[model samples]
Target: MHEFSIAQALVEQIEAAATKEHAKRVVRVVITVGALSGVDPEALRSLFPLVAEDTVTADAELVVEPVSARVRCRACGREEAAETSFLRCSVCGSRDVELIAGRELHIKTVELEIDER
Candidate 1:
């Protein structure tokens, strides 16, 4: 599954960050996943530990924040939540809508453990 690869990439990024900060270990990784991002949260969670087996994030907790799809209507200038299967505006019922959110796939925060000398 592509989630495995995504998990691997995530672990790599965490490792890089941890190295840069000279962290002893990664405590948590918070990521935002959009509804339209085509990523399965459960799959990613299941594969994360496998990908992080030998990395600094081996024991890191993966926290996923799900973002709902939102769109702005071009006809009525109304903004509202939308379903992935439907791109129409809720208020104006216009098909001409611009996606405002719910396509994100990025790390929001990284909690790390550092050794103090």
Candidate 2:
């Protein structure tokens, strides 16, 4: 599954960050998952631990924040949350709209442990 690849990539990134920061251990990783990003959160979560094995983030907790799709209507200048893939302006019933959010897959935060010495 693609989620395995995504998890693998995530572990790679985490390992890089941990090494850069001279982290003794990784604690947690917080990421944002957009509704339109096409990555399933549950699947990603399931694969993360397996991919993280033997890595710096093997014991890290994964936190996923889900974001809803939002669109701005071009015809009526209306902005609203979208519930489906077919985007339409709720106020003006116009199909011409621009996606404002909910298309991002990004890491928000990483918690790490460092040796006091």
lDDT value, residue 94 of candidate 1: 90
TM-score of each: 0.96, 0.94
List, residue by residue over 70-91, the lDDT tens digit for candidate 1: 9999999999999989899878
What C-alpha RMSD separates each model from the true structure? 0.8, 1.0
Give the residue spans of candidate 2 off by over 4 A: none
lDDT of 2 by residue, 17-82 (tens): 999999988999999999988899999999999999888899999999999999999999989998
Which window of ten consecutive residues has the lowest lDDT sum in model 2? 82-91
Q: Deviation in angstroms for 6 in model 1?
A: 0.6
lDDT of candidate model 2 versus the reference: 0.91
